[model samples]
Target: MRLTRCSGRSCLSWLSTIALTLLAGSTLTAGIALDLQDPNSIKAAASTCAYNLLTFYTGNNTGDVPGNLPAPYYWWEAGAMFGILIDYYYYTNDSQYNDLVTQGMLWQVGPDDDYMTPNQTKTEGNDDQGFWGMAAMSAAEQKYPDPPSGKPQWLALAQAVFNDQASRWDNQYCNGGLRWQIFTFNTGYDYKNSISNGCFFNLGARLALYTGNDTYAQWAEKTFNWTQAVSLMDQNYHFYDGAHTTLNCSDINRVQWTYNAGVFLLGASVMYNYVKCSNVEESDTRTDSLLSQTNGSALWLERVEGILNASSIFFATNPPNVMYEVACEPPNTCDTDNYSFKAYLARWLVASIKYAPFIQTTVMPWVQASATAAALQCSGGTNGQMCGMKWTQGSTWDGTQGVGQQMGALSVIQANLIDQVSVPVTNKTGGTSQGNAGAGGGGGVSTSDPALSQNAITQGSRAGAGVLTCLVLISVIGCSWWMIA
Candidate 1:
């Protein structure tokens, strides 16, 4: 159903379409029929996409799991795929993919187990290492099942990656920022990119959260400030592509990607939750500033919230709510590398809601609408289902199948585990069931990161008058939840 502007009747029509989509059973694997609010449905959808990864990957042993892409494993994309699998472990607590995750990460560690120089090399940029490092850190945070006897522990691998990335922090260009490429021979070695620094900040925040280490928190703050100081991230929290050192690192790439926003948001959220003040002391005066504000409002919270609002508001102006590739997808010129961009957005959106529940009222509607459109845009593929790049309602798949599309759709579906809305219901006995109370909007409940515990709603309640601004943008029509196919 096409949106005819934001009128009440049009909102009702959209709700009707969503209602029809949800009535289709949650098990439908071909296209839609995915209940984004149900854990079982999320697990099924994630399993389907994860199983599909093997088709593109070539490896027999555990270490070779994320092996070379049939054409040599692209570091960034493959790293993200590894992360999706790890997130699945965290979301569902099913250790089925533990070995794969462990082996895949172990395979990347150098002889010293530090990822400074991974076994494989296309271009060993700080950004590339940071991607893999973030994945390893995610595993460490989860204590991912385990590889095998004598293998490096997930924590050790992550620390090694952090140690290596920190060593490359050059103060020459922008006081402190990691270069895009580490190898002098690489073309962009002199460029300081958002991904590199964002990865560093993310890794530091996660490490700080998991290990309770203040150094990691310090690194997180410093890296975020460097990105801001250097103008890689603007005041509105709009992240530019990269800045070159040739011009005193003053030239901005002017391109915006969702993943950049995702990483920084998740990183800041992590810091906000774990690091109360710059000093991780129990009696620090600065800690008072943290508890007084809302969740995710301390440290990098303000900036994180800024980026989240800016991205959702400005990224996709045409469809109003859908998040699009601002630089590439608009022109139908997004290449394979751009395919997986939205997946990161999906990942961090859920992360933001998890660590910073106060933002749930702000981000829930956008998440619901986008995830619904993604599921609706899926088409039957050789392996059950494939989602397209453009996720407008009722749009057909572009006949494209690769890691990017698979990851993008998988991330969105997986995020449902965290951001799902339950509608209020009445039982046969005339009692109101405390179920999810939303279809067009969320329950406005905020939960802690799944890494904390399986069931921990840190804070959840009705959106008060203060959130009217967020509520204004959401079309609340008393909609019902659905699992569309």
Candidate 2:
């Protein structure tokens, strides 16, 4: 079958009309009606949902960058949208957005081939870079089409990101963990967050599974230990936000976000599955130790279960099985970043089901119920199908719309078809992307003087630095105005 190649505003307009045309007859007071059990019906719903989400993107327009979203949406989110699109293609086998996805993924690889694009350097956090890295990792895992011969390959790009982040494993703060922001000038540099460390762990476990490298697995283990040691992740597997180094990371931020839990959950699940699938020989003690360690697969399985059990907070008891962001959804205080957090949670939860099949019984009910609730909330906006942030509101529109809300809805709705597709493939299991063990070795931030702040400069140079900093802040604040307004 020939796939339709789509690009720019014309194609986006055409795709946006797809759901409206297909679902016009099935509309209810809630929104587009979806058949939860039918794969084809789910696919159609996903198509429309994805198209509506794409409407918020202006990056494909003439003057804008290919992989970026306009003001009010940060650069990290555009990376996430591409990851969702990658999953969209993997689940539905739709090539309609393949070109766009490829363009977006490759466009921001930055000068060093890591995700540290100069434009975003001022505000780029380790978590921000990790999100983009995970997108490239997803592309490699999904066996998405490779770039042209001269450009970076999918697996190599993921490896590059992993190697770069591994270099930033700071020892200066509370044992060892990555700082939230990459550059010290950024506000959150002194903070050590779960999402940043969790993303590194998540990427490491997947890379280990894909490449059969014990080094990646070892790093995953170390990261998990560090997170737990710092109390960012408690004994109950409840992942917290972060802790400031100024207090020696002793005072933990108890705020729980779905994405943080989701990140660690998927990483633990991947390690559990990896241990179960490993083929280490008993005679090779070193290899056996690497594969099992002290806790072995049992520890990871326990972690996987503990995380899922604790995640019950995100689901609404009133609705019985529907999912909601407990931290922000109830108070209606989710900022632009908070708005997109549930999408990653939903995305990882369904994915964890694939790695740990036993979770299917527990996960499917939430997936099915939440997908329907999310679809019902898509009844708002000018097009009559725009998704709202609060799915727990049921048919009530909640009077809001944006890329995050659309992404959250699209992610959950498309996730219903997860059972129909193949699980993520590894290099040993028919993955075709090329590998690079040393991709970003020389490009990451320096670890020699961890105490040295990038913001610390001479008074003579402060004028120039202040001017540049102001420009970046102005740009960021200008972009943020629309979202807060």
Q: Which candidate ranks first by lDDT, i.e. highest?
A: 2
Q: Give lDDT for model 1.
A: 0.62
| Per-residue C-alpha lDDT of model 1 across residues 313-389, encoded as one tens digit per residue | 43343344566667776577888888888888887788666555667776655666566666655674764466777
Per residue, candidate 2 scores C-alpha lDDT tens digits across 139-185 of 98887888888888888878888878878888877988888988888
lDDT of 2: 0.78
Model 2: how far residue 385 lies from native, Å: 0.2
Return the lDDT, model 1, position 444.
19
TM-scores of the candidates are: 0.76, 0.85
Clash count, predicted structure 1: 13
Compared with the true structure, all predictions reach lDDT values of 0.62, 0.78
